[model samples]
Target: MEKERSSLEEMLDAARKQFLEEDLTTLDFKIEELESRLAFSVTTEGGDVCAFCPTYCVA
Candidate 1:
């Protein structure tokens, strides 16, 4: 009764922690990928992304 409920709660808590850790790992990878792309975009042409646009792109 009480003992079983306590064990179940502990198991559920452990599962929740594992799920959050997996999500964090995935988010970390995605952040790294986005950061790399952003850095490349900013550096390739010159300064910012606007620097890459052609003259006609301006108003």
Candidate 2:
């Protein structure tokens, strides 16, 4: 029973790590894509507002 519990915890930890990695990958891709689209305009406040989704919303 102890071995089984340890194995389950390890699996859960692995899954959590994978989820974080995937989320970062997705965020990186979105940032790159938006930067490409905005080009030199990315630095402006208006541009920043237009380039990404709202922060308050969650999945």
Top candidate on TM-score is: 1
- Per-model clash counts, in order, read 0, 0
Q: Candidate 2 clash total?
A: 0
For all predictions, the C-alpha RMSD in Å is: 4.4, 9.5
lDDT score of residue 31 within candidate 2: 100
> Mind giving the per-residue lDDT tens digits that candidate 2 earns over 1-59?
99999999999999999999999999999999887886753444342343355542232
Off by over 4 Å in 2: 40-59
Off by over 4 Å in 1: 44-59
Q: Give each model a TM-score.
A: 0.73, 0.63
Candidate 1 per-residue lDDT over residues 1-59, each given as its tens digit: 99999999999999999999999999999999989876664554443344445433222
